[model samples]
Target: MNVQSNPVTASDTNARVLSYAEAIREAMAIAMQADPTVILMGEDIGVYGGAFQVTLDLIDRFGPERVMDTPISELGGAGVAVGAALTGLKPIFEFQFSDFAMLAMEQIVNQAAKLRYMLGGEAAVPVVFRMPSGSGTGAAAQHSQSIEAWFGHVPGLKVLQPSTPEDAKGMLLAALADPDPVMIFEHKLLYKTKGHVPEGSYLTPIGKALVRRTGSDLTIVAGSIMLHRALEAAEKLATDGINVEVIDLRSIRPIDRDTILTSVRKTGKLLVVYEGVKAYGVGAEISAMVAESDAFDYLDAPILRLGAADAPVPYNPDLERASVPQVDTIEAAARRLVRREV
Candidate 1:
């Protein structure tokens, strides 16, 4: 379907249909062109053009010096990025996959995050680390893990996950501008999906929630690919006289609590959905916030959480689908929370 979007005028009609990966590359291109200090460092990012080819053609434009490909060492490479950021360069590091970030947990969680505060604002690390996350591509147990909850627990660190093309561009720009370290968890499945993104420079403010859909009956909070799934479930639920509000908690850390509380107070019902395991995911955080806030009195039903099981992401396609929350899972959970029988 040809979707009508806000179009921006360019010098030529070279408006080629671009994927999410291309949108991200465009953001990097624009940022690099604007600032010489913004450099990319990661394994295969320079010559191999990244494991996902998201950094393709960047080396040719910026040359090998700025676009560097390091050895197969997450911890050492992350340390390099931290040192680079300390010495006045904005380094954008790419972990081949989200699971690899665990190898560099000390650099990210302790040193990079606590530098400014520990030194009384003497040292600042303006860095953006990109980690392709989630379990949709059959990457199995080791390569796939939704560990945003881990980063969100740390102070002075921003954790962002973009669910759309526009966000993919906007959030990256914002991450580069932050004085502290920002960890971006881009889901693997969203790479091929396309959406109309604005031309020229743009930035989506960090620590803000986006209300994707407006309604009065119920509010559904989600992030990453699950945000799109919740929006789909909202459309189907609408046909049955249920109006659902969809909130995309774009930034997991320093979450937009006001937006969430306002939505719950207005809608009176809440459903939190995500692809991460339910035990300690973003859903649990939001659920606890609502329970403790004044919004608790406004709840018409118990806050519901729909997420992956505690087990590892299965290799089998059927079990994989069953492992995480999908459209049907979201729909069923919403129905039960709203007291609607399917």
Candidate 2:
């Protein structure tokens, strides 16, 4: 297979609105067309067009050899992708649900993550693992977990969680270019969400955080679907005289500590909101980062994290909503923090 020596860059013209899933598919298609070395492998991604249909019609364009449909073994599929990456092919492996990654831990962590280091820079694994994560579809405890933090904790692996269609496309392209293993956690509920996406290939720099809204009263750090909720809460809080800054943490690993620290220092308060479980989640690490940094001195109040309850995601819609932080919950938490109540 042929590999494009030149990198794909952003285009200024021909921008159009597209859904999150469409943006992701567009990124993979662009990469495959540009570089024949890039291929896709996952369950039902061919005829079924993927569990969420992100890979729809890719097989028709790229053919079955490049757009392969593997059996129902995530471990086996992941292993194959890792091996392919090691052999100079860029493979995008999809996991229907992030929770299923538990079964592929040996391949992901032990093999894919450690191979480059074990080879002492002689080898590179250009594999991108896309996982549909989060707790919105009522798929129950098994399928609804937002487990990005689990992969983020590992070394030698870059973890990304894109919240918007623009970032979804940009980050995927960026991940395809990386030489090391990269894990992308795509929030399941954001699939149908629409936004303006650039027409051609673009790269959203990894390890950089985007400041969605700037404010002074408090800083709300959020990722994935929770970024949308935080923005909604920010709007409601604005009317209440609470000026809130919302930070969308696009990349989980190699987090933008400078952006987070600067925001917290300016606001004098930090509220980390996420859909992952409360204990030992991404929020905890962000809170610790600020608390351990110079930003801690600027805090007028204690750092607060609003995350999902310390329980499995419930299958019931109502129960699911309550288990995780909602718009109201985030707004109330920001209000309480500003008032020195919490």
- Considering every candidate listed, which one attains the maximal lDDT? 2
Local error of candidate 1 at 318, Å? Answer: 0.8
Model 2: colliding residue pairs = none
Q: Write the per-residue lDDT of candidate 1 for residues 165-200, one digit (tens) a residue.
A: 777888898898888899998988888888767777
What does candidate 2's lDDT look like per residue over 141-246, in tens digits?
A: 9999988888889988999998888889999999998888999999988999887788878899998888888899999999888989999999899998889999
Instruction: Give the whole-model CA lDDT for all candidates, comma-separated.
Output: 0.88, 0.90
For model 1, which pairs clash? Answer: none
Q: Give the root-mean-square deviation of each candidate in angstroms.
A: 2.9, 4.8
Top candidate when judged by TM-score against the true structure: 2
TM-score of each predicted structure versus truth? 0.95, 0.96
